[model samples]
Target: MNTRKVYLIWFFLFIFIPLIGSAKIDDSHIRSVVQILIYDNYSKEYISSGSGVSIGGTRVLTNYHVVEDIIKQPSRFLAIICLTQNSQSTPDCSYTAHAYYKYGIAGTSAEYQEELDLAVIYVNNKKDTNGTWKSIADLPMSEFSFDSINPALYGYSMTNIQLGDEIQTLGFPDYGNNTITYSNGVVSNFWMDDGDFFKDHDGVLAIGTSAKISHGSSGGAAFDKDGYLLGITSAEILDGNGSFLSGVIIPITTFNWWWEKVLGYEIIDGVGYTTGSISKEMFCKILYKDYDKLHNTCVCPKGYTENSNQECIAGSTPGSDVKIDNSTSLKIDPQLTNRLKGYILLQVQSQGEAWYVNSVDGKRYYMKDGSTAYEMMRKFALGITNSDLAKIPQQGEDKAYLSALSNLKGKILLQVESHGEAWYVHPKTGIRYYMKDGEAAYALMRYHSLGITNADLDKIPEGIL
Candidate 1:
């Protein structure tokens, strides 16, 4: 069979038969999972079912294949979410809601379903007391109860999950009568998709786990022991004889690309940071552990103050600061300071303090404090574009940059190709730290501070531009 045809056959085999459960899971996690029921548009008769987990609000994330047929011909098919289980442990038809067509990736090619099998569906209608589907209006929007994964544990930029980490899968499988099932397993392999599109991507696209999932488990949840949603129950790998091999999962990193790049949602640490997405109370609570400590990071949307220097120092009061003047009468010839570019000079005549020579302008800036150090690093950064930066091997990529770093210590490099972000190359470790802002520069200064004589600083003249 062709690859696409074989995948179609595999998708059908993996999506319909009842799925997951042998290990115990929390009740809250069980309640958050739902069964996706497909029905005939005209007859209202149940056709097929798959599993999904609530991400937030009314959105449920699942495999694209589970609803692919309905998406192809919405006029002939309908999809609804079953919120609870009946006496038979199957998805209860009573507590049901119709899914509102929402954002999802259908993929550019059928062959790419192995990497692109994901979708987001929304539930808008709920069954009333009279068994009639009505617009959900029973409770206050704030009172809507739905279990969601903590954003902190969503693990987008996280990489602590190793090859042998334990994992669990939760979904409804056919053998389990379309009821929520949980299974425990270990991550066996981490691999990329067999396509050019994702082969060169940054991280692992899929994970092969011993944790088993079945047909109805297509969109269910795979969680780490700490409740971090590792991925979704996506596919099953079979041996040459069509026997079970290992369950394949669509890793959260795959979801990260679609959720952020495709959907245009601003995600900060895996949580939507847009308006009406996360409340200030919830944001502070999640970040600082106390709503009142919002000032600690100065990241809150409102009520933060800036100093006369326009620096957003945490807990600084307005009108209580004086700005430092960058202007000076000191003069130095370009010829005299040109060779000292990118050098960290020490003033032996003073307190034996060190200063940075701007590689771009060939000027010396004092590293008086963290704030000043940050300002000076930015003012002196050498604009190296990406194509140019790539030529300099910071690591094993190229050794020329390393050779230069040996002589040019305490250099400030600016990636002009990017957002012009500044970075400080440590004099000893040769490591680079992102100078995010004054606060970050302050921390970098303390950690990478070096002492030298004042006589060396006097030899270098400050440049006036």
Candidate 2:
């Protein structure tokens, strides 16, 4: 007899047999839950581990903090999602994934993550010889029949459930030998976690449940009787002596906000608009670096500023003249004016070639390759004086940089004496994110990417000229 089989027999004889009267949790759903393993290069072992739920396709939804270390030191830290178990008490690392995006950035405070602790990491989906990139939906499973079991299904309720509703949570919590742990309890109550130790601020809404979960259960899913995701298991309340009191679940609606605002996708009626027809309003909302109040238009791309004629142009030094005549205007339609400006447009008709739409001139620049894109970005870099650069601050520093960052909101800055390296000074958080090379710029462009059809893309002229 296998040790795992023996353990399963005893577990069922004690745990599941007694909970027969409670809500039914399908076996497939239990198998669908996966474990997150964080391997540290220096330690040469998995230093930390957490749990996540497969939210269809190749993506696994988990708490942002579960993989925050990977975001900080991506090269040194590797994140692997394990889905199956052979015989050991630990998870089987058969699937490798990349940290796609988290709700917040690396230095964002714990309180902010607590309010919206969500992240989406995905696998390659190419099952080569090693089978490390297989999607959760394509993996083989047992012959267990299910009522509504589709591994790629993502059904969640939009409305909040009432108190006393029975809830069940599934995750690979600690002390359970890495096996999936299922715990059931009624909805205890709900409150808002303002991230204020003194409770002085108002914050996002949270759900409270009496379900039992451990430290490793941070990214698991809380499901209702009908097998819908109620919320994500985020944090637990502990007493003075470290005893478990209650569990805090971040609501599902927060994921909607993150999908649109952070991941650059617009959600409508619970579905996302992912085709080449993304709207101009959504494109500007997510990609704008600043607002040109003089012309009432958006200024985009780090290197360019909007001129008097509402065209994004290079070089707007305090004394330089960028006045353009109205006769030189591109004569673009009123509806499409500045619509695709500042967007990383993909020429879908030509082998997926890339182009960047300058916000000022409304012209497209060919990014023939990564190196060219990087150099082109440096060509229009804004040179700031040492005194002016000193006014801006780094993360964990003073709040004085807030006003400075606001004034230069979304501008790419080059230190007066530095090696011509550029830094993106974030407008909101007052922190500088280093744009190391063209690869980094390409990635950021993809994050800010919006698909454009050939017909619509041709409307904009080509090149910085």
Candidate 3:
């Protein structure tokens, strides 16, 4: 080769090679990546330290640990991907994701097991179209190869990485408090297997420099000075000096292998390449399924107790009974003071009878022939020559009082007659009650009417008659 030719080749290499390397990544690009938050259903808690990436249009890449259990029992868990941007305010942005794929590990042992730790989750870009999260585009895939020594086995290290390379890793770390904290350090060495740090896989080796990782930073990403992704943050090394110093990362090649298998896609130039439409509904459905399962297995709504049938039933407690003033021409039921303290009035209707009475909170109450409100004073005072006994009114032969009683408490007064229940006047609130014989009628009447059978009524306190 001539000297002139050699000079020209050297110039080209100096300029073009650097440009190609520079094209791989930059500071702005690194900021777009994200950390994932995983929920553990079995423990009913959050797994703060998962790692992930935002692939354009709200789609995210993460480790299977971030969403595996959630997908397995849709009812028990959910996943959220978080992106941090630069703003005067906090840079955090969150997106709910559906687990589209969970790549399985090949073996029980770390060495034999193909690190199938990759997971893909779909985010609804349309729903969150505000660009709150950076979109991923032009991603590289596993099929793409770079020319170098041992590329197949050793994998590509971060470009431009030297013994003293200054690098920054991003992740959500635990501070014992439930929030993410950031840590920074430099590359300690090129490759140092100071024990299982690289060997037995018991812990991470010292390939790069960093402070000890906190609780939630596992699965984060590490970037070189040029902002190109070096590796996925996996673990760290603690030294005998009581100083934690190095972070171990899975080479990018491992990410590529798992990405290809799980996403059914390829990468071009460090960008993930996809070929089909991903549905948002399917993604939400995954979370919804998990939410439903958890909700069902958990406790019932408040103010209710489980019945013999495992169904929720209303709570029961004693209520008051009051008397009416029969001497008054209007025959107004005696207004029971503090009537609202203990019981609610429920109205019910029966085809055979037209009126009935019940008690709550130590008080006997009566409903008019068609009223829903339980007139507390009427039951004790109406047609009663003595305070202990009262005359039961009969509308006609074979047709006794059909109104039912209940004990409920609420401010709103419901009109029971509109639903074909009998009307009765309330002495305390002056509201009218109508009786209907179903649960709706009882609820509408705002009473404790439990659709109690005649047999059940026999169990009431003797004073409740």
Best-performing candidate as measured by lDDT:
1
Cα lDDT tens digits, model 2, 5-48, are: 10000011111112223566655566456788788788788877
Which runs in model 1 stand beyond 4 Å of their true positions? 1-24, 85-90, 94-115, 137-145, 151-158, 193-201, 268-465
TM-score of each: 0.49, 0.48, 0.37
How do all the candidates rank in terms of lDDT, highest first?
Answer: 1, 2, 3
Error of 1 at 339 (Å): 66
Backbone clashes, candidate 3: 50
- The parts of candidate 2 lying over 4 Å away from their true place are 1-21, 85-91, 100-115, 125-159, 193-204, 261-263, 267-465
lDDT of each: 0.55, 0.54, 0.36
Error of 3 at 128 (Å): 7.2
Each model's total of backbone clashes: 17, 4, 50
Query: Quick one: ranking by TM-score, best first?
Result: 1, 2, 3
